[model samples]
Target: MNRKNFLSSLLTIGAAGPVLAAAATPNAVPSVSRNTAASSAALPTPLIIPPYLRPGDVIGITCPAGDITAKEILPATQLIESWGFRIKVGETVGKKDGVFGGTDDERAADFQQMLNDPELSAILCARGGYGAVHIIDRLDFSPLANRPKWIIGFSDVTVLLCHLHTNGNWASIHSKMCNSFPDDWAKAEAIQVECILSIRRALSGERMEYKVPPNVRNRNGRAEAALIGGNLKTIESLAGTRSDIDTAGKILFVEDTGEYLYSIDRMFWHLQRTGKLDRLAGLVVGGFKVKPDDPGEEFGQTVTDIVTARVKGYGYPVCFDFPVGHQKDNYALKYGIPHLLDVQEGAVTLTDTSVPAAATPSL
Candidate 1:
């Protein structure tokens, strides 16, 4: 949808609240404070910042999601090794059982070993397709709690990120995985190279800051809160589960790929109804590769239209197209770390406030 038409739809939707209200399902779960004193509370005091990678530290590559051949991960391994870190290829790599990296038991055991390995400074998923949820309940996270390390990836890997946040209060990396690595680094597009390098920057503990051109649909404001989010459909599916994220007083960002507009709207409705959208410090809309509607069945609403409708009464900054998702522009984001989001008329900036300004490298 074009900008002019999208703005018009937003105004119309704003005036017709009853129509949208009638379409929403009642929230089934009671809202709980994410900061509750319970031991299992989502946000524990002094959130665990996993020890960052240092020269010669080992980074284990495991396929906790879809199966990836050894040949496919060579580019990623080579690139990471060049950054001064060692690589330990997990047994799950190249192992396959249907679409999964391996049988559930195998995948779980491989990941459990990585979590307990004292030599490893971080774990990177080979790729994200599906299957993390299958083994989420099977593996133990206590080893990780005792020795925290960065867990990285997006898409299906959102399961691990959210589970670590809610259950262990440990921070993780949300960025591109092995399959995204370019075969020829010398000839790769600049943006693709930059996106991949972002993983290294994140792992080495350089503070992150991202800026994008301002969108006309963006809500102007500023907020400083822990940034939390990943794939939208995955977050919605996790509702009421132990891995479910607690977004109250945090900046929530979401992106997805290959979904119809109606489905996106439904997912946002799920967020709104569950009170996830009620108290957010801000909202960020990332790369959504929407599917075209079938003939005569068009949803007739843009992502901006749907998001604006759901957050109508809330007064938090909302920025669309913030460059994170299943696309090449996706940058590394630290889940559970505090960030400052500023939406202005000229640009939108997301700054990682958990680190000192002197530690942030130039963009």
Candidate 2:
């Protein structure tokens, strides 16, 4: 379908009028209407991690995005098994044709099998490439809603995270993916385990605290909103699609890698024209990895400078150098989870119980 009709059809979903927040830029992040914050809603108390995996519980692994070979799976699976969970490799785990792990059918099939397996306690992605989008629509999530598990990953994985939150409203993790662990990154693997444990604690009604770094353009004095945004390009591509999210009154987290400063500016401009930045409650940039080409084109731009210009008119809180995005020890975040963003004191806190603890009991 052409982008115009494609978006028009999406806008007319149901009685709840189709909410469209951005109009001018077709490539910018699209907008959606946000529900008002329930100050007394008691905020998210920690998330409930699924039951601890015993030696027999299965840890499902699939390559919904990139392709993986046995080499890619062996070490990763060994690590999971070391944690005592049985490894359930998906059919599409190693089905690669080119850069993608497998065809859309094969990839979606793998995810479907894992999602439907009642014995799998948590499903982990082997890697994050670009194939997830191919199967995102092909797979059914009804089974997943009935048996929600710790679906984890970052980067392109953010696509699934947003869809899961926006469509099924499932709370998932935005932590490191399996690829983050190479043969030598065992220490990295150890940190991932710690992150997984936190996921478990969060799901089991235990809260985790985060240290919000000081901000230069800190805008919100005392405002809190749900956390969202990862891999700026990925998030920007979702605009005008069902996967897109509303940013109003939300802590907008952004980060990018291997992107020219000019490209970053264009994306931000696209975001502005679409109103994604203007309607946001605040802006927080994760480590914006800007690497210039040899004989540098010299765009005379920095990620921080580009973001500031795009968001200056909004006057919401803006923070930078946050330990997120393509970096080690990336901060963990609960997409769609309500959070408090304080600019004056330079701290943002995520409420432990946005979804009542009772509603999401210990897995």
Candidate 3:
């Protein structure tokens, strides 16, 4: 079907209601009802971690969101290949249908193909713009249930990450995509180089840990639980959908770019009202590049003020200015995997506590 017709069909189904719309999709995974206020006890099944990549393992690159020319991903391919992994460029990489990488069907098919390809150890998103939600429900994740592979990217890809976590209990990488790759590696800033290299370390099965200077507003405490979250706006948008996250017993991290303080405050309020902030292992407030309020219309509160006001009653650790989000220092985070969040007056640290695949409990 053409894009226009497809969208119109969606609108018709949506008008009927979300349940009917989801039920109409043959391959759609049923949304699991969760207890948002569940205790912080360990889950019965540990998150499934896809096999770590090795020398010559194939990493597929597909454009599930926005358009990106083959020439643009050259730097990313060259760099990833340097890490001893082969690159399999998907058909949607250079294709364009309006601002999207391709038609929704095309992008979904490309990603589904990668997910089912046994040779592809990981699928790296070429970029994240505004189309991942358009194709998410259309793709079948049954293949991933049997042969899970690392799904990498952030921004719009947060929809995919959250869907994987909420529905399949699969672990994924939340990090920079192809668009963030530096064209000239030699001239890249120190932070850029470090962030890019962190992706390699994650896919190679290295235990991940990071430390950042503490903000005066940080609440000192420690908690260990599965870490989950991404762009705040994206998280808020997924509410009431199949991809909506369950934060009952997890360390949640949120970040965003180019939003007004009031908008940010509203999103936080949504979280609180929806019981997302009622119980948590901790909260990591990542880099938020708030847009300046218009003249004569300033929002009286800062990001920290807005956050602390909401979670003041919760005893879990709350740290600000975390090094994750749309910034040069944005580090890779393992979604669905258990992590240790330590907040102290002097510093904050997040550590991956994933066990060997053989030792991990299976679903």
> Could you estimate the TM-score for every candidate?
0.88, 0.76, 0.87
Model 3, 86-112: lDDT tens digits are: 999999988999999999989989998
Error of 3 at 116 (Å): 1.5
List clashing residue pairs in candidate 1.
none
- Per-residue lDDT of candidate 2, residues 1-363 (tens digit): 122221211212112323332222222221221324322222222222233234566778888898778676786677667656688788876588788878877887888888889878678888786867777766666554334466777788878887765554445667666666557544556545555455445433344455565766555544565677787888888888777866655667888788877888888998888877766656778877776855746888667778778776655667777667787657566665655555556465434335454554222
Please name the candidate that would achieve the greatest lDDT relative to the true structure: 3
Ranking by TM-score: 1, 3, 2
Model 3 misplaced regions, further than 4 Å? 1-44, 355-363
lDDT of each: 0.81, 0.63, 0.82
- Writing each residue's lDDT as its tens digit, candidate 1 over 1-363 gives 111111111111111121111111111111222322211323433465666778998999999989999999999998898999999999999999999999988998899899889788799999999999988877666555335568999999999899877764567999999999989888898998898888889898898999989999999988877788999999998999777998887889999999999999999999999989888888999999999999999999999999999998988889999989999899999887878889999999999877789987846
Estimate the TM-score for candidate 1. 0.88
The global Cα lDDT (0 to 1) of model 2 is: 0.63
